[model samples]
Target: EEVTEGEEVERKEHLKTQWARLEAVVGTKARITLIARDLVKHFENRLAALDGKAMVVCMSRRICVELYHEIAKLRPAWAAEADGEGRMKIVMTGSATDPLDWQPHIRNKLRREALAQRFRDPGNPFQIAIVRDMWLTGFDAPSLHTLYVDKPMRGHGLMQAIARVNRVFKD
Candidate 1:
């Protein structure tokens, strides 16, 4: 059957408009966990993709120290371990140290490694930290919900963190 030219144009225009509307509403980061100052606009949109659930966080060491102090003393449990239930673990991935004071960079790496080992069973830990490292894009874990970033990231690095929580799970 011969197709009408006007009908084709009209259909194409309708589809284009619909696509634009859908994108405007969802954006890029919708339905994933977020790590930022506010949870209003970007974070909330991402949360929609998640359908609102719990997630684990792999945090950096320096930031973890501060977070640790607050969570332990301020509102929730004091110990890093969750009491009588599954607790989030911190896998602060880092390297070794030389002379303990020979190089500032070396010292920093040591700190990160120390933090990663803190959790012991990082594969299953709910909370973890990674200073000077990235794990969200490639690493897969069921409970990894939140990504508390305290480092500078842009371009592909940003995309990885957003992908971390979009993974569909049965739990």
Candidate 2:
């Protein structure tokens, strides 16, 4: 059956409305807080005994920062003001031009490399890494046992992100 031009337009409009609604729901502060609380609960109750690290893949840089703060609030000991002192860290790349709140997570190449090295170590306190797009591909952390994806990813991107936790690691 052929779709009339009027029907096609109607369908497009309906899709646009749906997309807007989804964006509204997803961009709310309450939803972010809820997700943060649930993530902390999952980590403490489920992923704690795995003796491995976890990565959280967020939809955007802003969400990454917000979620990180929310999680930090729930688990104060998991957060630190300095990069060298955090159990949970945001590992996204950003610039000085970005918001001042993001400056701590925005590191130079050497700092990023240091963070990467720490993340690769199974015994390091740096366990949870909140990221937008940096370590999704061409990065390997065998000790990474859990991946919490809050972003919409598909095709090769999705596969690579999931593969972050698929590495072989000894108990």
Candidate 3:
């Protein structure tokens, strides 16, 4: 049955209110720091044993970068000044016009391709990748066993994101 315009407006207003509440809680620095610590603990206790890699799907590019830094603070070895040398890296595309702080995490096409190659290698030190949207589809790494989703996703996009960890790896 077709709904009235009033219902559509009500639904939109409800969704906006929900999103605002979610952002208020999740976007806080304290919450992000707690999440970062939990992620590190989870990695150490579980994924590290299997020699597995993980992906962190964040709400946005800004959150992706913030979470990367928070995680890095807990594990300095995971952070690298150079794009090509980090164990934990953010894979997002951005232009020079974007915020200066975000520039380091942003990469050109070739650099992203290189990061993709490094991530595909099971033996490589590159283990955890933080991303907003780039690798949610058309990317595969068999050794990846965990997906830490801090973002809200649904339907096809959600399916594709979770499927990143579903590829068959060795026994």
Candidate 4:
């Protein structure tokens, strides 16, 4: 569908006019820094209420790294600088050959499975997981009660993402 300037204008005006008649849904367009801030706040609140973990889905690895740093700043205990033992949060993305200083947590398939297991474990404090395209589907975590989506997802992909938290747990 080639949308001309005039047609685009008309479409926008029509949508604007019908805005009140239709339910409005605001999508994500915020800066990564700001989104990270809100994500932490949501996690803190959910922890208090449900005592569960949270997952953050980003559009790209770059944004995932950016959000990880931002959230790390707010929650020092989750940052790599906090301790040598481990961090509370982990970034799970596809492995890269040329390693970057910011993405120490990027893992291979086997290691990714390990991290996914840790995230699923209730005993572990690995609370928040930041991902680009990994773990949105076929990964089960019953303790994960919160998901902050910073990317657009639809259809089966969206359903699978929601299924991550829609598991039955004894807790």
Candidate 5:
């Protein structure tokens, strides 16, 4: 699907609006932003605060490149933080390939310290790109409270997705 430049912009705008609505219902301190090209900045500024804090970066295979690039930039800084004691930590889940398995341009591969994941069911799932990813369901991160969603999603998936940020933390 060759979505024209115009179409992609429209989709981003639409997602931004929806996110504003989801923000109200999501718990305090929890937020979702629709950052098109600035995904890296958002991650460094918002998600980075959780670095070395025991968290999961759940996202679709499609955007993993952007995620990877961003994390690569921040690795040095986090390496100093001392995760869970004396280690730097970051857990990512996605298929062995790319996040957007549909896009041939986005090639996924094992890079640096990041690990890959393959959800049991493949194409059988109703693919609503805006929402498909491994970090969405049944995943827990006690230190996770804010989620930055750069993609789209709806219905049960939407609810379960952000809910990943709801786990309680101690001290």
Candidate 6:
């Protein structure tokens, strides 16, 4: 069932309208932004007490970027230069054509692996990672004490994500 260009545009506009209505019924962007700011502050205190890192899982790449920027505004220390050293970073899969892809943190296998390694190192500056769907499995970070999940998950996916914070780190 191939649709005409006009039909596709109509469908997209319909979806956008529906999405806007849904957002109004559930939560507004301003409310979410305020909560994200508070969540960063809350987690900062908790993570500091535990002497551990954290991972924040978002539902979409767009939300990941949005939350990162919001939190960065509150905690300027968490904002890292795309090419320089920083403790906080966003990890999401993106292709070369994706305009939102950060040059230093583009989501390739090699870059993902490198970021994971840094996240796992307690002495390293990379303390927090914001992710959408990456590092849900086979990635280990014993020092990761908390996982803030803004996205929904169930069954195996849910279990694997929970396991991320269950590892024991020798202090």
Residue 35 accuracy (lDDT) in model 2: 96
Writing each residue's lDDT as its tens digit, candidate 6 over 1-171 gives 111223677787786666556545434468658867778787879966778888888766666776777777777887876523676888877777666434445656776777888888888878878887788787888888888887657677889999999877876
Tell me the tens digit of each residue's lDDT in model 5 across 1-171.
111233677787776666556443441222222232253455456644553122233233333433333443544343222212212223333444534533332223452112212111121111111222554677544445556554455577678866866665544
Q: Runs in model 6 with CA error above 4 Å?
A: 1-28, 100-105
What lDDT tens digits, residue by residue, belong to model 3 across residues 57-159?
Answer: 8876778888888998999999996866879999998989988889988888999999999999999889999998888898999888999998778777888
Better of 5 and 6 by lDDT: 6
| lDDT, each prediction | 0.40, 0.84, 0.85, 0.67, 0.38, 0.74
| Each prediction's TM-score versus the true structure | 0.40, 0.84, 0.86, 0.73, 0.39, 0.77
Error of 3 at 100 (Å): 1.8
The worst-scoring run of ten residues by lDDT in candidate 2 lies at: 1-10
**Model 6 clash pairs?**
none
- What clash pairs does model 5 have? 61-99, 61-100, 62-99, 62-100, 130-152
Q: lDDT of candidate 4 vs native? A: 0.67
The regions of model 5 sitting more than 4 angstroms off are: 1-60, 74-132
Cα RMSD of all models vs. native, in order, equals 15.4, 6.2, 4.3, 8.2, 12.4, 6.0
- Clash counts per candidate, in order, are 17, 0, 0, 0, 5, 0
1 against 5, candidate with superior TM-score: 1
Deviation (Å) of 52 in candidate 3: 1.3
Top TM-score model: 3
- Please give, for residues 1-171, the per-residue lDDT of candidate 2 as tens digits: 011223677787775676557656675799999999999989877565678889998867788888989988899999997777888988877888999988877888888889999999988999899998889899999989889998667777899998998877894
> What TM-score does candidate 5 get on C-alpha atoms?
0.39
